[model samples]
Target: MTERFYDQLSKDFEEMVSWRRYLHQNPELSFQESNTAKFIADKLRSFGINVKEQVGGNGVIGVIEGNHPGKTIAFRADFDALPIHDEKNVKYKSSVDGVMHACGHDGHTSALLAVAKVLNNHRNQLKGKVVLLFQHAEEKPPGGAKFMIEEGALDGVDFIFGGHLATDLPVGKIATRPGPVMASVDAFKITLQGIGGHGARPHQTIDTVAIGSRLVTHLQEIVSRRVDPVEPAVVTVGSFHAGNAFNIIADSAILEGTVRAMNSNVRQQIESEIRAILDGMKVADRIEYSLEYIHGYPVLVNHKEEALLIEKLVKETISLDAFVEKDIVLGAEDFAYYLEERPGAYFHVGAHNEQAETQFPHHHPRFDFDEKALLQLSRIFLQLANHYLVTD
Candidate 1:
C-alpha cells in the first residue's frame, strides 16, 4: 500500500508543483486567507473528499474514512504567508504586493493537498480515517490552530503529525528530535514616562532616553547573567523609539522586544527577571514605566515515541541517510499547540538547494526552497498514515 501511494505521488509530482506555484504566486496573509481556503476546499471536493470550510477562521478540514476500523490519524499544514515583499525573480514570484509566502506555507499546503488526493483515491483500502488540517495564521500569534482545536478539528484524532520545509537542512533529508524541539515565543513592550525639558537643563527632566537605554542593557543581561548557561534562551530588543529632535530631551521612551526559552520554568524566570529589572529602574531612576508582556506560542515538544516513529519511517521509506536527528531550535511553532493536546510529533523536510539559489532562510524576502521537497514531505505523511491505518 505504501509503495503504491509513493508511486502515485511520484506520478502526481508535476500536479503538486502546479498547486505549489499557484499558491506561491497568489499568497495571502495570516488570518485573511479567504480565497486560499476556497481554493483548497475546491480541490479537496474535486478529489471526492469530505470538506469543511470556514473552520477556526479560514482553516479547512478534509476527512477520509476507511472501509475498515482502526485508529484515526490527523495531519496539519499551515497556509498563511508573511508580510514581506517578494524579491525573487522567478516566473512564479508572488503576484501580491507587500505579501508573500516567504515561510514556505505554500509548499506545506501543496504537499498536504497532494497527499490528500492520494489518500482519498485509496480510501477503501485504508483502516479508520485520515483528517487533513489546513490551518491558518501560523505566522501570527494566537494562531488558527488554537481556534481550530476549540472547534474540534482533533475531536476524534488518536495521533497527529506535521512537517516543515527547512532551508537549514539539505534536500532529500528530514529531521526531528523528541522533547522541546522549539522555544516558547513571547514578546514585551516597555514605556518610560518622564519630564521633558531643554537639553541644556538636564537636571530638570528625568531623561527617559537615558533610562530606556539602560533598560535595554539590563534586559540583555537576563539571558546572559540571570538564566543558566546550560539552558538556551534569547532576549532581543527589536525596536526602540524616543525623541524626534536630537537637542531636546524626550519625555517618554518606548522599547519593544521578544523573548524565547526552551522550558516553562525558564520562560517564567525570564519574565520575572524583566519585571524585577523594571522595578529597579523605577526606584533608581525615579521614572514611571509600563511593561506589557504578550505571550505567544509555547515551546514545541515532540512526543518521544511519535518522534522516534517519524525517524524510523524516514529511514525505512526514504534512504537511511535521509534521516537526521536535529538539535533544538530557538524558533517557535504554533504546531506546538496540537502536540500539547494530542500525542504527535513535528519534523522538518530539507528544502535547501545550494545550486538553485534556494538557500535563503525562512521569512526572508528572497526565501525559497527546492520544490522537490514537496514529494519528500508527501512521502513521509503517506508512510505515517499507512503505519497507523494499516500496519498497526
Candidate 2:
C-alpha cells in the first residue's frame, strides 16, 4: 500500500512543481500570507482532506482520518516568504516586489501538499489520522508554530516531523541529528545617549559613536571570553548607526545585533555579559544607555528516537548513502516550538544542483533549490507515515 502511494506521488510530481512555482511567483511575506494560506487550504480540500482555516493567525490545518485505529502523526511545512526581491532570471521568479520565497517555504508547502494528496487517496487502506500543519510566519519571531500549537494543532498527535530543503547540500541527500540541531535566536539593540559636539573637540563631546564602536567590539568578547569554550554561541553586531555627517560628534548612536546559542545557560550568560559590559562603560564614561534584548525562537532539539527513525528510514526508503549526520546549525527555526511540545525531528533535504544554478544560500535574493527536492521531501514524509500507521 505504501509503494502504491509512492507511485501515485511520483505521478503527481508535476502538480507539486506547478504549486511550488505558482507560490514562488506570487510570494507573500511573513504574517501577511492571506492568499498563500487560502491556496493551501484550497489544495488540501481538493485532496479530500478536512481543512481548517485561520488557525493561529494565517495557519492552515488539514486532517485525514484512516479506516483503522492507530497512532496519529503530524507533519509541518512553513508557507512564509522573506522580505527580499526575487533576483533570479527564471520565468517563475516572484511577481511580488521586495518579497520572495527565498527560504524554500514554497517548496516545503508544495511537497507536503503532494504528500497530503497521496495519503488522503490511500486513507481507506491506512490506519490512524494524519495532521497537516501549513504554518505561517516562520521567518518572523513570535512565529506561527507557537500560535498554531496554542490553537491545538498537535492536540492528539503521537509524533510530528518537518524538513527543509537545503540548497547548500547536494541534491537527493538528507541530514539530521538527535539533539540541538539548531540554535536559539535572540536580538539586542543598544542605544547610547551622549552630548553632541564638534568632531574636532575631544573633551567637549561625550562621543556616542566611539562608545557604540566600543560596545560592538566588547559584545564579540561575550562569546569568545565569557561563554565556555566547549559551548557553541555567537554574538554578531549587524548594524551600527551614529551620525549623518562626518564633522559632528553624534549625540546618540544605536548598535543592533543578534545572539545565537545552543542552550539556555549559554544564552543567559551572553545576555548577562552584554549588560555587565554596558554597565561598566556607563560608570566610566558617564553615559546613559538603554538595552533592548528580544528573545526569538528557542533551540531546535530533535528527539533522540524520532531523529534516529528518520536516519533509518532515509537509508531504507532512499539509499544507504543518502543519510548524512549533519553538524548542528546556528540558524534558528520556529519548528523548535513544535518539537518542544511533541516528540519529533526536523531534518533537511538537499536541493543543491550544480547544473541548475541552485546553490545559492537561503534568504538570498537569488536563492532557489532544485525542484527535485520536493519529491525527495515527500518521499521521506510518506515513509515516516507508513512506518507508524498500518497499511493495507
Candidate 3:
C-alpha cells in the first residue's frame, strides 16, 4: 500500500525534521503568520483533517474527504518567513530576530504536514477530495497567492500541487519543467527631476546625478539591446539614489529595480522599454520624469498536462533518477497566482546536501535544508493524492 505509506513516512522522518526545525526556530513575517497559522491549524486538527481558519489573513485550509466520488486535489504549502536574519548556528536557530525561515518555508510547512498525515491515514483508500493549502504571505508583496485566490483558495480545486526547496537542486533531486517554469516579476520606480546646483557650478543646475547615471546605463540597454536574445530578460538596477552633498548637485534621482521575464511578449516589451527610457531623458533642456511600474508574479507556467502528470507521478512514486527537467528561472512565484487560476504544476524538491549541510541559497541569511527532503515531500503528497483520485 504505497510501501506502507512510505514506511510510515520513514518513521515520522525524525518527527518531520523536528517539525521542520521548530518552524525554523520560530520565524514569521508577511501578513505576520499568527504563530505560523496556529502551528498549521494545530497540525491540521491533529490530522483528523478538516480545519479552515482565517482564510486570507493567516491562511490555512486542510480538508481531506474520500471514500469514493473522485477528483479534487490541491496541496500547496508556503507559510511565509524572511526578513532574513538567523545566520544558521542551527540547533533550531532563529528565535525570531529579523525573522527567518529563509525560505525552505520551514521545509514547505513540514512537507504539507507530512501530507496531512498520509491523507488522514489513507482516508478509506481514497477516491476524492484533498485540499491543503496553508499559504501565508509568500515573501510578501501582494502574494499569499493573491490572498488565497481572494479568499476562496481555488474554490473547488481540481488539480494542484507545489514544491520548492532547492539550494540549486541536489539532495535526492526532483525538478520539473514544461513551460515558462518561473519568471515575471516586474517593479520599477524612477524619479529624476532636476534643478539643484553648486557642485562647483557645472553650468549652474540640472544634473540629477547626471540623470540618474544615465538612467542606469539606459536600463541596461533594456535587457541588452532590447529584449529578445532568445527571450529571457532581466533589467536589475536594484536601487540608486541621488546626491546628498558631495558639494551638492542633486534635485531628485531615484530609480529602483527588478524586471524579469520569460515571455508575455517579453513582459510587454520590458514594460514598453521602461516607458521609452524615462521619456528620453532630456536633462539640460528641462528635466522632469517620474515613472513607477509594479507587477509581480506571473510566469511559473508549468501545465503540459500538468507536466505529464507530474512526470508519471514522479516516475511512479520517486526516483526515476529523481525526475529531472528544470531550468528556466529568473525566479518569481506567487505560484504565478496558482498557475493563473488552475492547471497546475510547480515542482522542485532537492534541498541540497553537499556532504551533510552547508548549502544556503533561498533568500539567504544562511539558508538551510536537507531535512531529508521531508520524506520525499511526504511521499509526493501521498502520490499526488492517490494519483488524482484514481486518474481524475
Ranking by TM-score: 1, 2, 3
Superposed on all Cα atoms, model 1 deviates from the true structure by an RMSD in Å of: 1.0
lDDT per model vs. reference? 0.94, 0.93, 0.82
Error of 3 at 378 (Å): 2.2
Residue 305 of model 3: what lDDT? 88
- For 288-340, candidate 2 gives per-residue lDDT tens digits of 99999999999999999999999999988789999999799899999999999
Please, what are the lDDT tens digits per residue for candidate 1 over residues 247-266? 89999999999999999899
Choose the strongest candidate by lDDT: 1
Instruction: Point out the higher-scoring one by TM-score: 1 or 3.
Output: 1
lDDT at position 101, candidate 2: 93
Q: How close is candidate 3 to the true structure, as a TM-score?
A: 0.39
Off by over 4 Å in 1: none
